[model samples]
Target: MNSLLPVPPRRHWSTWALLAGLLLLVITSFATLPLKWGDFFSADAVRTTADFLHGFAPPELSPNFLLKVGTATFETLAMSAIGTIIAAVFGALLALPASGRFGKAARQATRGVLNVLRSIPELVWASILLIAAGLGPFAGTLALALHTVGVLGRLFADAFENCPPLPAASLRINGAGPAATFLYATLPQCSPQMLSYTLYRWENNIRAAAILGVVGAGGLGQMLKYHLSLFQMQPAATVIIAMLLMVAAVDGLSYVLRRAMTR
Candidate 1:
């Protein structure tokens, strides 16, 4: 009997070339890293790790320590929430221009500003702000907000640009103004996606807020650093647990909100 199925299409030359190039790049990149494999699993390393880990047993659960951790936890949450809110507002404003709602010159200018803002890591921003604003949650909050604006603005602009043009075009043809077209057509399509991005960034900012505290920005990370510096592993462990719990809670909330949005 003759075979009924058609032959599968062969991979394109460009695909194979791209794969080969990626393989070469990965090999070259791996060769450049200075990895000391001999020390990684050495007996001394194992003993040191075990000893350090031993100290973390029975985390500090004292009333005062718990109270302090609770306060720090709230601070981190507030910083992340406020930073995200400010970034969303500012990012949306910039995104309008970057999305080409404005002319090409405006888009280029807005994008350039976003590139500069997002190029610097949050920690670097925090470090600089610390010098100017003095070490506190304020500096950390600003750092998170600035970096997030870059990220969110870029994402929002892309979302707006990718929105279906048909509805917007129809609105424009019917004498709807640009603002009305955006409000009725462009926004409705992309707002859900923008909200999803904001929530995801908020999750990241929470983790960043915790780390920023290590630089004396005032959060749980500062507490973790202090305890670790004094070799107080139990207290450090408590902080770590608190960080894990906070991250989990945010993740859970994001999941719920995202699910609701999809519906």
Candidate 2:
């Protein structure tokens, strides 16, 4: 028999089921959303949006504002660096246990902890820290660090795990302890992936820092909010331009750094 008896479709495993569930949630959410798609094309909506955009005029010369922008930009850089460094250090520290190269029991415990940590969003963490730290870059930095730790730690552990065990295991067999083998073998293999993810996160943090002002963290986003409230489109445009430039610069630098490391 040629088995025309209807072949089974793919089995819905945990991953596929999760994806399907998410799709259903999105479908249900769209049904409840207040927005109408037609509004984007509506005359009034277009006119209003155009008028708001127009308010952001001649972003050419604003020396005082530029200086302020410069300071805010620096603050953003500082925040991203501090947060990322803290997260990277701590994440690396914790990721080892999850690598399963150490022991089965430790790997399970570490993975469970990492799962809990990675489950929460950075914004939620930021909001909570904002409460405890009372409104500043400190709160934003802490928020980003805490969240980054979870993300990068899990990623690091995975990268470590995915590497060929031969090199590390050989070192261990030759009397290398877990730490020694990691330094010589596992860390090097994961280095490229780690750097790439870290750089990506750093870029994201720049964008996140810009908007953390909604929680009173204070950055160019705060300035943008102020300008929008007062209907100062020109200055707002200037801030947006500056952010674009900053992000572009970060992207370029990261590309160079990654190439250098890989080479």
Q: Clashes in each model (backbone N, CA, C under 3 Å)? A: 0, 4
Give the 10-residue window scoring lowest on summed lDDT in candidate 1. Answer: 1-10
lDDT of 1 by residue, 1-263 (tens): 35887878999999999999999999998899998878989999999999989999999999999999999999999999999999999999999999988899999999999999999999999999999999889999999999999999999999999999999999999999999999999999999999999999999999999999989888998999999999999999999999999999999999999999989
Off by over 4 Å in 2: 1-35
Top model number, TM-score: 1
User: Candidate 2: which pairs clash?
Assistant: 55-233, 56-233, 56-234, 57-234
Per-prediction RMSD in angstroms? 1.7, 4.2
- lDDT by residue (101-187, candidate 2, tens digit) is 669999999888877766877678778888889877898888788878888889998998899889998998999987788899988
TM-score per candidate, in order?
0.94, 0.84
lDDT of each: 0.96, 0.83
